[model samples]
Target: MNVPVHVLKGAGGKAAEQMAAMGIETVKDLLFYFPFRYEDFSIRRLEEVQHEERVTLQGTVHSLPELRFFGKKKSRLTVRVLVDGFLVQAIFFNQPFLKRQIELGQHLIFHGKFDKHRLMIQGAIVKNAQSDGAFEPVYPLKGDVKLVSLRKWISQAYKDYGDEIEELLPESLLESYKLIPRAEACYFLHFPQDMAKFKQAKRRMVYEELLMFQLKMQYFRKQTRESTDGKEKSWPAEKVNSFVEALPFPLTAAQSRVLEEILKDLNSPYRMNRLLQGDVGSGKTVIAAIALYAAVNAGYQGALMVPTEILAEQHSASLKELFAGYPVTIGHLSGSSKVKERRETLEKLASGEIDIIIGTHALIQEGVDFHQLGLVITDEQHRFGVAQRRVLREKGIRPDVLFMTATPIPRTLAITAFGDMDVSTIDEMPKGRKPVETYWAKPDTLPRVLKFIDKQVSMGHQAYVICPLIEESDKLDVQNAIDLHRQIQEVLPHLHTGLMHGRLHSDEKEEVMKEFAENKVQILVSTTVVEVGVNVPNATAMVIYDANRFGLSQLHQLRGRVGRGSDQAYCILLADPKSDSGKERMAIMTETNDGFELSQRDLELRGPGDFFGVKQSGLPQMKVADIVEDFRTLEVARQDAAKLVASEAFWKSEIYAPLRQALEEEGVFRKERID
Candidate 1:
């Protein structure tokens, strides 16, 4: 991990200090930050050159043409440099330094793009001709970073300190996976001798990183398991069934299956750690409500923790209605409640008066206590870290945990991120929740869309117009929420309109949300901060401005804010019509309403960065792990690692001792205890 300060300096001078700002401290970090792309310097045959491509061809030197300037300022210098075998025009606008770099009759390795008329254009790579040019990895470079110099520097680094790199993974896992040597992975990652080793190296690194992450997760799950009493509340499943039957809508098969899985955990002595994956309008709350009912029936209180006070209040209100006739008093605890009210709620919770409590992080605060908490449910599961959830669990009597999320994660990411939990997905939306109608439009079409919203508002319906920008910014010319709020006010002057963005105070935000929920506001203009933990049943429309700026999962979440009620939801994705990417995004939105597929698309488009960003538990630190590129390796590693770690045999193995110590390390990813 120690990068010589000299490598960045080129000659080991003050230049080294500049690259440090980018968080590039070590050679290892620099090496691992592989090229986002590569410019192939290997010779391309010119006669068969294709248009709009990077090509290299070897032939006798064609005549070097004139370096011309076409601009009025005469500053635009265009250099047409001929390759060894072919004639091509290299057009550079005001690029004088490029002319100095090019030479005649040198047999130069010319690397650039060619258009239909053999015009070499745009940003392309060129190099000195070499007799033997291996697969050159053009790393993401700085002042003097290219395929050639970077390789030389990295070769120097390995030549000096390659032996010093400690093999981090266990020997058995490494051998069993047929992984490349750790040093080899590092070496080829920077300058791969061939593509086969390059691919293999990527696999090894991905597997190594995922394995470490999986092991850390297993450690935490195991550590938490030790403290639990292996106690399960023996409540009649029939009561839950009665509650389900009593509901107005029938439970989907997915709901029924997930509930059975939950009941099995409740019946068993083993403490449960389960994830409930429900889509946008899926009925995760009902299953949680049934679990709460069971806990109360067994004479023990339960708590449901959501990420936001707004959602907590929403859950509390719903549960109160659901458990109306049942012998249970529900308590709502949140920062929004008055001090005296919070105290009253906490005291009732400490006593036997409250059967179920729902709130945000306020429920886990110092003064709040639960007399006998038997079950705990967390909505939007990724919002809270393992430590935060563990603190909430400590509030209960070894409460069995049920984590629920709307983000339809691919199973691999779910297992990787929440490996400790046995996942249960209520994949089907409740029978009647209509799949939202989706559309992609431009700002120019706003008159028609606003008219459409006006019609809906006139018909006594509500809509959410989401803006990308929060406020009027000097830097960005895009529409801001406050400005848009004012503009929308002009169109729908008589109707109730509300603005909700992250900049608003918590109280103001809550008030606006309350107003929206009560149908006080016919239209709510907002930012993406509304992505998490908002529930409005009456609102049937979601209009996202600059829809291309959002990821698919985030857009889905925003769309989920509406469609909670029986209303047919409409998710209108509004963006500038110019971008092809924007068009593609809108198409994804209009396509099948499957979270799994959307998540996969998201991963493909943006890589696994979205998963880490949402998880917010700290990024999985697999030095070699890339869930996208080397997913197969990661899967294999996960299977092997899970089998070993879950087994008693793992503890007895010679490698297990160090592996356990690795898990115990301060920053090594498991159950990190911060004072």
Candidate 2:
């Protein structure tokens, strides 16, 4: 089954090149080229077929096929067939060569969609003489590769080379799961005899894919826990209590509990690989600050990394204020730092003068060293990958890592995506944080929304006008920020408006954010650049244009910008949703302020791929299993993988040799360090 592609019949240089472009270079690839859809072609009499119904008919050709040309590059082959005393005409487009093989009075079978009004079939397929009445599969295709040629090549390869395919799953697993042999699964997937066979084949493939993924995740989890050793620093109760009392507000119950969990992990011997999840404005940062305080009190250093420079600067200022009365020294480093300033910060860091440093990816840059770095905490952890986290941890021997994210992930996804790390959830929000009132409107209702913004601004409040794009796109009809700024200025000439986007310079972005935070800019028209950490408590009104284009979690984040203060806040979603999914997404935003619920709904609606891009999720692309639709299968696979990894006999047996080899070749075990 691993034979060269050229060994398959009809796989010449051109065909092989096309196949290679589609990630198919071997006979095994051909066997795994699963179909996107299947069409029922079981035999049916012509007279019994209804209009617009797909059917397969067998009969004798009434007349010879005729080839007709409509233009220089357009041609069609027309043929007549008599089936059960009914006459039907079949047409094949751009297939003039079919006229040579089809003969008058010859018995043939046709499979296609029937048109009873005209008694004609638009697209028809002539079955091979040896083919029986079976379902037809429609495959994902490359350029210029006809379905007939691909089908014939697959059939020939299966007949000649299928037996050579080696099964990777052990016999015990197969028997327990009731899975068919690998070769038969491949065959049935492409050319199933019936619906039952198709479902069984698909089930086996999905289970295998999920099982491999779970096994790899569990293996990495165990490896990282055993191979790494962390600092054993204790959190003194009086020190933690004094730090909490110095804070501006009392800690929420949820935050206090999660902080206890972090303390327990820090005192343990194993490197802490933990994820702290909370909703927007749920006070996750305060918990991180407390953990960092414990590290510094224990005569060690801590580091906090964020995704954006603005966020880094914000954290630096906030941490300084939080540790005002303490002896801890906080340093800030970013890409935009001056040369002398960065050098001085680096030197201070190396000499252990700085107890904690807050920055962006600049923290991981060369020449940045820490003296006894004990803890590493990353905010908005999804923006960074496992490798980046490992690099930062490498700066120290084995630092305890706590990753914080405000974008809540559903529990089901957290198990598969972040199964390697322990999870902590801060489900409660701080007191006095009111849920922002959300509403939906169409384009015609913009006047009412604009009036509301004007009223809010008149009340000494600010507003945010968010657009999906900075510039106009010829392909998309959504309004751009630049144009929207102009329109807002024209509509409400009294209000001061400013524009900000990713294209702006770092200094310019910082200036705009500062102006907004100081209540200087009453109306800030921008893109999603303000989605993360640009917090302005005075901004009470947010109008998102084309809101349907954004995901539910993202819309929630944008809404979080407002409602930060004690005043009533409003988020107006201006969108004319065209699809049912779009409308549903908009409705979900209006229905709930809970991030975890929205995340679950978002996963169910957009699936994991769009929920978190493939790169951020750190999950390998699946071939057969869908993470959303096959959650039950995922659970089963996860349990089975745990059992397999726990059994030493299974790992040492010959049946698992191929599985291990396949995993190694795929580099599953050698992926980024979980820590």
lDDT of 1 at 316: 81
Q: What stretches of model 1 exceed 4 Å from their correct place? A: 1-40, 45-77, 81-107, 112-121, 137-187, 219-230, 385-387, 611-617, 646-650, 653-675
lDDT of 2 by residue, 1-675 (tens): 787788987797999999888778998888888887788867887667898898888888999888989989889899998878878899988888888889889888888888999888878988875666678798888988888888999999989988887888888889988999887888898888898999999999999889888888888777657654677887577988888887889988999899889999888888888899999899998899999999988878999999999899889988998898888999999999999999999999999999999999999998999988999999999888777877998898678989999999998788788877889999999998889999999967877888999999999999999989999999988999999999889999998888999999989999998888888889999999999978788899999999988999899989988998899999999888675657998998999999999999988987888888877686567777887789899999888887877789657978789878877877876784333
List residue ranges in candidate 2 displaced over 4 A: 42-133, 245-250, 385-388, 577-581, 669-675
For each candidate, what TM-score against the reference?
0.84, 0.85
Model 1: number of backbone collisions: 10
Per-residue lDDT tens digits for candidate 1, residues 104-164, read: 6545555557774745654444455664555666555566434565566567767766777
Task: Report the lDDT of model 2 for residue 186.
Answer: 84
> Each prediction's Cα lDDT score?
0.74, 0.87
Q: Which 10-residue window in model 1 sums to the lowest lDDT?
A: 57-66
